[model samples]
Target chain A: MKSTTTWINSINNRFWRTIVNSTATGVESVAVFRIIMGIYLLFVTTPTYTWIADLPKALYTPPIISFVNLLASDFPGRNFLVTVDFLMVASIVGIVLGIYSRFATLAFVILKVSVLSFQYSFGKIDHDIMLPATLACMAFSGWGQTLALVPDKRSKWDSPSKSLSVIAVLIGFGYFSAGIEKAIHWLNFDLNSNGTARWFYLGLYNLQRQPILAPALKNAPFWFFKIMDVVGVIFELTPIIAVLISRKAWRIWLFFAAAFHLVNYLLFNINFIGNGLVYIAFINYKPVYRYVANLTKSYIAKALILAAVGYAAVIRGISILTSQNVGIIFIPDNGNANLYCMLIIWALICAALFITIFKTGKQPVHDDLEVVSPQLT
Target chain B: MHSLKFTGILFAIFLIPFVLRLFGLEPYPAILFPSGPETVKQVNGKTEIETKQLFAKKQNGQWALVEPKAFMYPVSAIQLAKLVSKNMGFKKQKPFPLKGKIGIVNYLYRSQNSSSSAAEEAELRNWIKKRLKRGNYQTSEVKVATYSNIISTTNGNILKKELKDEKYYNLD
Candidate 1:
């Protein structure tokens, strides 16, 4: 009896310690997440300027103002919207530079939500949601402290552990909700019109409107899809499980997760790159960070990272400019040339990432990036 | 903020909403997944390829096909789609007779929770009724119909018997 009680007590202690200190060693990984988030958000929101600039004259009634009776019927006009666009750009810069990161993040949250409310006021709401959610978490976390050009030095509450802990839980919770929703869907599956998983699967295939892939998916054996759907439900729940398990289990789960996303992308053109990228928060990247830091100690690594970032920026700018008349001087003259440029850019990024991760001959890369949770009374 | 306070605040933000969820109070629509499954609408019959363009408005006490923009000013065909999804339903409208002079609005609606939300339906109808009344069209009876395909709007004078020929409201 005493032995069992002691074992239970030790387990309880260990669990809390893991929760409290899971983030102590994820500063570098969290930094990478922050930088990726900043760049992605800027790229994502760049297209909104055209619509935002026409808000005053645009037909759809902006949100919040619609339900309220006393708000202004007349809009403030396109110039005012231009000011909003300019401010958004400035905030994006701040997010990237890590200068006043908290403020920039808050500004981003408010601005993005405010504009999105207007943009979708007429009704399509699911586009580009991951960025805002990501930005809000980073704003809540002190992620800018490590990787920013000018790191915020507020030491009181900006510990890596606290910041990362908050982010990890949020991500875990997000995926868990998705998994739960799927379960709820299947719960009513029996009562649905056709009363089977086939209807549910067909609904998911965009009502058989999936042009290229629909025929194959339809022709596949019914048992095949039913089993895949069941597996998908379990896999979706694995994200939350990943957060709760040991580091080794978490890594294994994430590997399967990457595969799941890839398969979904192929089956449906629904690429959730932004959502997938945020999962890096759970990884212990101390070794990766250390290697990069060491490599940066040599000028070659510094130049390489800078080159990667620069190439990434130019590619981003060109893609955005080509799609919209953003008034940029340099435009991709042709689609084939632009595609080639993108491939080269990706290759460069991969080379930089590979060298930073494995090129340092001082030590071999190991799979033991586990962080020890400190016992706290 | 001290570390404990920081931790406390963060957890509070997470937990309060969770507790609210337990009590059946969903958080404000923000950066999160739907609290429940957002089932993608599936229509069995031939559906209009461009859904937002198909709409039927009640004019002169008769349901007639009309352009969506006539009712939802400035809402693009795509924007109209966003509005139809209950989850994406846009809030806020310009105050004065929201989209003035438009009466007896008509548009395609694909909503996940519309079947269950009678109160939501009543509230919207009342709002639209008030708007239509101000625009000099006496209107009554806001009824919603779901159909798989709405081929095209017929000419203003088409008889009710001709609706089948126009492919309007042809539910499978």
Candidate 2:
């Protein structure tokens, strides 16, 4: 009887703890999601951006419509899709800045989904679907709960808390949805015994025909392709098992799925519905921040920030003086590089924030803040 | 200690799908083509032979072959377009017929008109006798030759006459 009571109390504690942490995470996510959407919109619409029309030509469907093909077609005002893409980007930025976030989130969801759907309207996969879903969740969840603009210490709605739970659930749904899609494709969907090899052969043939990567990927053999095909199938199917098992399992599943998506973006130059965005949505944000904070020694945090700032200054200075391109040690050209740059910049900013907090004698932000009601206190 | 281990496990779990994706498993959608018919017929006069058509139609839950008598091999659009362009003498080559799109052509097989006198005559007589049996046509005006598994039907078209195979026909 005593042990049962103890177990019940533990469960209750866990439930309440989760509520508080999720609330905080949800608030943080609004900022991140908004900024990301804005940047993406701006980047795609940039006049100097050249890759808009240079997608692999082999991706053409005989009976179905394709975005690239549509762009090349006699369709009127087709340029409006780019305008919508830029709007979504702007909306996300607006959302993150906590400036008219509700309206921004709604606009972002509508424009992003419509354009992506119309672009790949012949048919689209999970990546295309997930972005709109994320935006929809964000819109309803009151993601920007703790905004600098609002400056409200005591609020009734607990907006961020509600949003966090919704976001986490949606992110989980994205994985579950992908798993479901894979199950559909794999059920009695045997390409034949030698189908795997044939599939790889077709992929390689398609890759070799690509104007950009043709020279590099053309020489890869049938055996290499066969292995990749089988392995790819296994990766697609593994997530279904991963997300349901445990919290640890979900994290692993999400990480590898993100990496898998990243690799596809890099090697195959596929970018339609990217995996990274969906992966971010699935993450246990509070735990991740806590874990990273714990790993950084309180002493070295300042030095790390200084080093980063110094490195940035040196790179900037060298670029300005030489009038020659710096041979930076990094992934070059390709769409993948932009994502990598975003990740780096985000990490650097986070690190700077952490150092500032420590130096100013301010406590690291707690995963949960319990604001007692005036009447209770 | 437990939290650290949990964190490590979490990271590993996340990394697995990505690693699998990197090595070549994509979580993207599969693209497929529509089924079409098996047999195509080109009826010119009383002589009828099968012509190759592009797509097959799915009827009553079964895929019916479009050109039943004519064997179909998956041919690339570019190759078919080139063949048609060369024959038709188009100013510029057009894009090939797509998967669901069908292309129709009027094709004929030809036999030799040669100086190998006696042997050619014997071959033509044998050819005429075979077509008479298979086609069941009493018209002796149509001369037939069986060689290279091809049954040619010629009706005094010089273009058809110019193109000859291993078989022989009499100059009647």
lDDT (tens digit, per residue) of candidate 2 on A1-377: 99996776666445433533432334444444444444343332221111122212211111122333323321123245445544654564465445566677788767654444333322222244555555665564444443323322334433443444444444444444344333444333232222233222223222221223433443444334334545555665565344334444545555555555544444454433333554454332443444433433355864663464345334433432332223222335343565666445434333433332233221223433223112110
Which parts of model 1 are misplaced by more than 4 Å? A1-16, A20-24, A43-45, A53-77, A127-130, A140-142, A187-212, A290-377, B1-31, B34-80, B83-172
Chain B TM-score in each of the candidates: 0.35, 0.18
Could you tell me which 10 consecutive residues in candidate 1 chain A have the lowest summed lDDT? A364-373
> Which CAPRI tier for candidate 2?
incorrect
Q: How accurate is candidate 2 locally (lDDT)?
A: 0.36
Give each model's whole-structure lDDT: 0.45, 0.36
- Quote the lDDT for A248 in model 2: 49
Question: Where is model 2 more than 4 Å wrong at Cα?
Answer: A1-26, A29-86, A121-127, A147-200, A207-231, A238-241, A282-377, B1-172
